[model samples]
Target chain A: MVCIRFLKALQSVLDSRITVLYETHKGLGARFVDFAGWRMPVLYSGVVEEHMAVREACGIFDVSHMGEIEVSGPGAEAAVQYIASNDIERIVDGQCQYTLVCNDTGGVIDDTIVYRRSADNFLFCTNAINTDSVFCWLLEKLHGREGVEVIDRSGEYAQIAIQGPASLDIFKIAFGIDTEEIRPFRFIETTVAGSLAIVSKTGYTGEQGLEIYLAPASAPAAWDALMAAGAGHGIKPIGLGARDTLRLEMGYPLYGYEITEEFGPIEAGLKRFVALEKGGFIGQKAMVERAEGAPKSVLVGLRMEGSGVPRTGYELFSGDKAAGNVTSGTHSPALKYGVAMAYVAPEFKEPGTRLNMQIRKRSVECTVVAIPFYRREKK
Target chain B: MEFPEDLKYSKEHEWVRLEGDTAVIGITDYAQDSLGDVVYVELPAEGDAVTRGETFGVVESVKAVSDLYSPVSGSVVEMNDAVVDGPEAINEDPYTEAWMLKIELDNIEELEELLSADEYQQFIEEEK
Candidate 1:
């Protein structure tokens, strides 16, 4: 491995105005890109290669850019439930629930993963750019409350995700922790790499994997230990590039791309995660109205029939009519065909409906297909 | 990184080779290296008029789409259909095998604006 101190100095000299990775992703031959005001690695090896590594064997990702917020104290339970779109009461201790923070109009503020550590303590994993804003929002929500505390612990933690079919076994090998007991959405606070970490069995990709949230100071040791343990396991370091493709293939909604301030969970096909029955939350009325009324547009998957790549902001046309716009699209590295998720008219949201993706001045034909272009085979 | 000494270069990192009054144009090695995995290439058809320093085509990589500028003001004489058919040619051999277009020069004086191999090397260095 490359030296961390040397790279830290080199990166500072190179770009002085960006978030530096304390776990040392810079020295690992990662190609850094300016992502959401931070110099984050977009790729270490080729995206397709690293992607295949995750799908076939094992791959590790430095997802330290994801923000974390701590909400713990008296009445934290009710406060978290009020702030989140999902039913946080459903999860027991050491369980995570995928959720969304919504605007008053039911538009999604941000999609987040809320981990319930205890009845009075909940931790939210927010999107990197949305951390400060969400923290401020949480603070604003606790105005009438006396004991609830919202602390932005985004910078204090480093999140390393080891994802693949072999990720569980590899986790056990690397950290001497058996995660077989940690079923889907379940997590365990364990000693890993000689540091306390929360190993969660959750992933963006539709694979059995672990997301280890550890202290920033102990991240390098954990990363090194994982790498050393995974050396014989065909482990590759994945980057944000592969991360995009993997999540996209799984039909996962990225915050800005799919779930944004422009749309709500019902329109984004996250109805299961949104708990309207639980009630007593922001955007609850708007969500109820949306559920009772006809939505303007709904998210759907598209499979390209022709050759051109369908990218974000690409217009969708139904015959000669303007259908909608592509939110997140990519040439799916797994399928070897172009795949995309877009919001379209109600008529075009049905499967087998033909549409076109406007690339440059030309249109590439596509068809509305089911979401999640890839799913791992159950053993 | 390989900037052939024989071929001339433009400020936009396009290489030019003089074939009598005609100029063969393609992006330089540095250009392709930066683009990374050219997935799709869109080029103007033959007989299309292209002005100097204007977009003649677009090269789409896995990352982003970049406009390809013409090195000289001319009418397109020939098109390299290979790049449109298989875009990876641009990444594999951007100089010879992936020539974007051949233009019938409107004015040979435009060649004076082009840079030599040494000057282009310095230009790229300053850019870095």
Candidate 2:
């Protein structure tokens, strides 16, 4: 009886409302477009200038729109293990792990960050659009369990991602927290601008940086503190324009655009998260049956040999026959070439496999490359 | 922002300079700004016949790659080698040194039908 009511409440929350992050810049001349119900910043200045800022110097990204959730109580770890594809048994306090929450059919519900705050408490940082759906899914799963508590902390918190090579120094000076001791995927709770913040050594840009989480009311102060400290070091408050290109360069998948419900985690090259060894979880039986082999349209990186760019929805052809379509593409600022990720027939997923993109109905020759068209230099 | 009075413009943000039987063609400043960071250009082969309002090639930027349409019916006589080699010239200077192609105008009357510099500026403003 309680499970049924809990499921109803969870469904109501999912259907309630969509939150948007609007930046009123006083008509600085930006072409605003609606993305996943959020009016995100595509480009404030220019895509190239902003892209260069992150690669060369540093850039501050307003990532407050990302969803934040908290799980606590005795059954927190059990609930998380059942909900997530990766085993959470090894997660220690003050560390984070990137994993996915999948549907029963092994389809991705959302890719998120699991931050274990303590033995019985953790946080799930999810993509903005998947907030309500993920929360509902977690609740629905937890409704059948006993002594599990899940809270939607998204409204209470705001996140700012300071990314790029210069991020560590800027973060250290801004928050007066020594970042040298903080390793990748580790976090430390500290005060920034007289407000409590949890600084995590993690970012989507594949650089040395910290994602500072603070109270929603303290956002303005936190933003100001970081900008002021990073002003001399060439840290600019970048928009979603550079953020997409930076992640694209690193070949990170964006939900709905790259990874979708129609494509399972195995086809998307994310089988590392699904642990068959773990006793049981949602999607376990189906994943186990398909583990032997499943004919999949595999995801791969596409690079143009000629003077053209392969964009999303552009048909990928293997000698006049349609094989797949591009999921994401951009002129990589670091490589200075057009790069894209796409799903193609498994037979043609190997590197150096020649393919063609239908640009304006004409096939432009391209080659399949390994994932992550660009990688950060080892320090 | 500098739209020379002698040039004729298209609503798609292409500019043409009528030179008797031939017209030089390129994109306007507004087009470059909207596209942002011209990285590569695909120009049609010389002597390829093209019609007005038909896509001839593509111009790639960091954000998107859009089709470049022909503003006048003609055969492609020559393409700007400078802009092809260094595409940033299109964003740096779209009018003089960054002209895209030279077309032997099939009908000179097509130029008279295009928007004048003043009209083009007004069209851009209306778009905004």
Candidate 3:
């Protein structure tokens, strides 16, 4: 028994990948968690503290685990338009669009961001766990096609996100670049911290921020430079724990949780991102059928009225009937209450609808609320 | 992690301190540290009965949920409302201010099953 346990532990250690900033995170007193086969920092100071820093000040995240794929050649735009649910044609060069990739039956493969660098060059940022699968799916779909090339560029770059109200100022200070012209969803290829990087005005957290894609070897120096420049802006290193809560506060659908292969984008309340009018995509037919028919279930946000935090897989109830189940839930550090994203019967999707979540032996009351639970006021 | 020498420990990481016929129970420092930044806590009512080695409540952190096991069987006499209102107290001071419940002992003999402070320290070390 001991030998088996030892071997298992050894195997896990060998299998888990560490980011380039692993040593830096360790030095800053980070508590690590195994996320998608990567040993990532779950927290440095605390989840709540890091969460607040992003809301009020600034926070930097080592998101190097997120995968990057590049599609280039004359047929790049065609290849992307065929696979992505959103209309890539809508985004011009230097802009990006939040989109989804789906299978033949219209089930979501992954929620991704498609960046149009030029007419012949595009990039995809995919979820860490789904990176390899997404890469293969893109390759298989574009195989035998002329003038299109798909490459898995995930290992070549490390991604970092600096977010908050003060992000622009920090960016100017750290990289010596005037980001005043960089609108949301737009990016610029420039040198930062003595390395070539793609600085995109995008982030999962609903805050003003930039996600920088730079070479893996230059990540440590860039992280240090950002932190140093953000010192006066009250910047802190954020971890995955706060990252989940921050995105949850925005009511964003995480790939595995809200958007999954079993549920399409329509059921996940992301129909707007699916450009059904743009025909000939992989899942257009099924998605159009789903949009016209009554949905099996619809995603809604639940705010706890009573005590006890709702957790993933907990069943929701309306009266005595089982409504649905919680997909992702957490105590909102910003809201000071428990909030959750749940899939319930279509009849129970109204914002003010009341429901009960079965948490252990007790039923905790919650109210269906409009998502974007904590939206930032427009500056 | 500080393990009070006067208190007995359970294998599930609960600590018990006897005061006359009433026993005060809380999680140990090691347990609270393991559960970082507790966000919510649910405990039994004042009159509820708890059995030894059974879960009496739950402690939730941002990323995980953990059950609180009773080290000794008893009828709950009182619950620390402060800890319930602000669960971060458990992370701040698990031993004194975060004492979860005070219960009237159902079987004083259950204390014999618990470990000494030194034994618990050794146990956690071996667990790691």
Q: Which candidate number would show the highest DockQ if scored against the true structure?
A: 3
lDDT of 3 by residue, B1-128 (tens): 79989999999999999999999999999998877779889999999999998999999988789999999998999999999998899998999999999999998999999999999999999997
lDDT of 1 by residue, A157-241 (tens): 8888999988888888877788888789999998877668899999877778999998877778888888888889888898788
Among incorrect, acceptable, medium and high, the docking class of model 2 is medium
How would you encode candidate 2's per-residue C-alpha lDDT over B1-128 as one tens digit per residue?
A: 68998999998889999776889999999999888888888888789988899998889888877889889999999988888889999999999999988999888988888999999999999998
Higher lDDT: candidate 2 or 3? Answer: 3
lDDT of 3 by residue, A1-379 (tens): 3464456456656888889999999999999999877999999988989999999999999999999999999999999999999999999999999999999888988899989999999999999877877887887888899999999899999999999999889989988898878999999999987789999999989999999999989999999999999999899999999999999999999988998898989999899999999859998999999999999999999999998787889999999999999999999998988999999999999999999999998999999999989978777
Q: What stretches of model 2 exceed 4 Å from their correct place?
A: A1-31, A320-322
Which number leads on TM-score? Answer: 3
lDDT of each: 0.86, 0.82, 0.92
By summed lDDT, the worst window of 10 consecutive residues in model 3 chain A runs over A1-10
Clashing pairs in 2: none
Q: Given the true complex, what DockQ would model 3 score?
A: 0.70
